[model samples]
Target: MRDQVTSSDRVNYGAVIALVAISFMLLRKWIAGGVCKSRACLDGKTVVITGANTGIGMETAKDMARRGARVVMACRDLTRAENAAEYIRRSTGNGNVVIRHLNLASLYSVQEFVKEFIATEERLDILINNAGKIEFDDLFFDKRPYSPLLSYKQSKLANVLFSRELARRMKGTGVSSYCLHPGVIRTELIRHILVRFPVLKIILSLPCILLMKTPWQGAQTSIYCAVTEGLESKSGCYFSDCAEKDPAPEGKDDEVARRLWEESAGLVGLNPRR
Candidate 1:
């Protein structure tokens, strides 16, 4: 019995060691960092990033500021935005970083932000629609009970549509718009879900967490979209991992893009222009 127990213990230890090794390899691959190699300077460029207070948005803002771009962090929380702006300014030594209040959930807020931006800023060089949520059943047109998951999906779809319409409108203009998937980033965006389910939090804390990307790593594609030259003609396309990728069928539908733009304009109390 003692011999058998010893053999079992050895087996368990070997399994644990193997698991650790595999987890390390997975983590190395997961965090294989990618950065925009373009040395293009944004000396006179203006970048407005929504949700720039945290996660990939903050990292993107930092990168832009490092390249001498004026970054405007549009966030709902003034205090947090200010804190992030201070951090970016200190880190990048870019004094042009500013914070503006924006709440994507409210059309009034969106309109107000647009009005203020147009009034104060002379040029809008890049618009990065980086903020998204994962709510259940929150479809824009759905009258059913509020589903946070659906709401999140609707918001993402809205980003793509907005970019598409904006690109069409800015065809001749120098302003460019980009929509990107920042990857499965490790951020507080999932805190609400984890708070409700302790088990999930534990699982995510395990070696499997290696699959997630840090905020800085997740910002690579956005940086690529913003400062990379020769991409002026590729506006409105979706990107991931610093490369363009095809979006879902719904996202690629021109009619849907037009309709969503009209609906969004109505929601924001703006007259829709083709």
Candidate 2:
């Protein structure tokens, strides 16, 4: 009886180990599924990526810098931005990586960054609106609390609107605007949320750890949009997994994009006519 019990315990442990291994294999396959694989270089082009102090944004900056582009890491955190820039420069041997302050939550900060960028840089080849927020019960400037889902969705919608409006306004310019879904990357973006809800964090921790894309993998679609040759003509199109994908029905509404552009301009104190 003792021997049979020991044998049963060994079998159970082996089965558990086998299950874990299979799970990891599946997760690895998923994470490694989509890749850009483009070797296009940026030579003299200038690229700006917002929220580039960490995660997919930083990875995108590093990839662009490796292709010989002048990369501006627009971030709200100066210290982290500088550190990321330095890392990119050293990793890519491209010393042209610079950091600029950009606080996407504040309209004033957005306008200020644009002013400085336009004044200093002679050309803007690529502008990537990569930053996003996922907040819960956030109060807008109107002092009314918005549902977390709506607040986050609106923030992402702004990225699409900004890209479309920028493409329209810069029609004749050499600049191109691209917005991408960087995949479900494992980044620090959810640290605060996880800290706030420990039980939820525990539930999500294993799957998130196994299945989510690393920052570099997540940035592939953005890098693809930025460096792909023919994509210059496909401005304002949404991209995912290194390919153009149809956005939601609302995202495709040009009228909404235009209206949002005007409203955004007003908020940022920019001339709508410009």
Candidate 3:
């Protein structure tokens, strides 16, 4: 027996479809976060991006390349880096993309990269330290068991402190510093976590896509901070979603930031006293 196609039933179906579409649109808009509305060009600028071979770093590099900036991709994996650089060059039609080796885990590598860059490159307009790992520094972890997640959080806080102190120190030097939260993008970071616990791959599959930002979306604030004018006045402030946002109370502790800077400089054999 066939059910009659009543006008009320058709209207109900249309209303349901329209409601679902509108809900999806709202969810997408909310998840997209703040976009970099600034259409500033970076012609004649030289930008260096760490971890530019993947995720938000690569996306940032591509945007700079498209803006006619000479982008140097500093990445740990030379092979992957070359591939990323090529992709950037081809997609951007800007052949100024270059690749260099940079292993943040190794101080020696950092020193070497800096030396080589200073020797080869004439000027550095922007230095984006976009690479980070699930690494250490407790404040190195209150004598607790070493957990990667805790280590990563500590590292991020350390970055905020470093950026704040750097901005204070670099004032009047024609340089600016900024730190940001990229809003939990679905990048290779998730793959690493899933590798350790494969079950999470299944558990997180739905939410990862539904809730996480794409690499392009995550890179928006980085691009904004790098190229947006008038942001110089707000340098040192923490940013998220392409706008200035206050960090937590601990992050704003100038005394702690300065102390951490001194300790970090000592560890890295740098003279922050300069």
Candidate 4:
């Protein structure tokens, strides 16, 4: 039998579909907001955020601090971290801000940062992996024309890999580790992509700008993962927009995660018990 739909039926179906879509979007946003609004959940917690000098990381640091959490802004540049922390202190009126140096690409730097963090504090409540970079051209925009691009992907992968390894090591230490993606908010990070492909960048960025969350919105997930009640059980999970995310295929490789851990341990000279 041939299935047929009347005009009124079609219209009603379309309306239903549109309503469902709108409801889903609004529901997601509301849940995201609620996760961050819990007052006592974050109070007195210590959170360390990488790349907190700017963009979503900075916003997360500020938001968490406002909720009475001690925030540590970890960045490679000491000056920048301190400057960001000062801004947070002034804005939130919470002075429990500390600046620690952390360079994600360099394992030695991560080790030093972790050592300092562990030495100065007896307990760590949260560690947020928010640092990343995007490089557009290798030998100038036109000189190297069209080669395979891998840098940005590599950095993102590293963020997840590091979080997994760190979570493993911190298993019994009462510290929860999480990796977060801030939903590609407008920031200096996108400048590299924009500069390389100016026209395409604008075209691509348009949809993201329209639908993408603001830096404050982007910080929602990290804040949620950092403070939510059942989060300790979700350690090493990748999160975006306050939802648990499935890391890329490579990110799910337990062996690779272990290798990265061993490699990092070697770099930091932390001997693992075989």
Top TM-score prediction, candidate number = 3
Per-residue CA lDDT of model 4 for 1-274, tens digit only, reads 1335577788899999999999978965754342465464456667777788988789989987898877888888898788889999999999999887666766566656766555432334343333332232332235545433454565566667768877777887776678776665666666665798888886877676655567787777777776677677788887866778776667766676676667656656667442
For residue 38, model 3's alpha carbon misses the true position, in angstroms, by 1.7
lDDT of each: 0.75, 0.74, 0.78, 0.69
Candidate 1 lDDT, 37-73, residue by residue in tens: 8898888777778888998889989998999988889
Q: Which tens-of-lDDT digit does each residue in 1-274 have in candidate 2? A: 9999999999999999999999988878777556888898778877777888898889889998998988888888999888898899999999999987765876667657766655442333343333333222332625565566566677787777677777777766766677777778788887877899999998998888877888888888877776677677787777877777777666666776787777767766877777
Winner by lDDT between candidate 3 and candidate 2: 3
- Show model 4 residue runs off by greater than 4 Å: 1-35, 41-45, 78-83, 100-105, 118-148, 193-208, 267-274
How many residue pairs clash in all the candidates, one count each?
11, 0, 2, 0
Instruction: Indicate the residue-level lDDT of 2 in model 1.
Output: 100
How many residue-pair clashes does candidate 3 contain? Answer: 2
TM-score of 4: 0.67
Report model 1's TM-score to 2 decimal places. Answer: 0.78
List TM-scores for all candidates, in order. 0.78, 0.78, 0.87, 0.67
Q: Model 1 Cα displacement at 120 (Å)?
A: 12
Model 3 CA deviation exceeding 4 Å by range? 1-7, 105-142
Candidate 3: deviation at residue 113, Å?
A: 3.7
The whole-model C-alpha lDDT of candidate 3 against the native structure comes to 0.78
Error of 4 at 1 (Å): 49
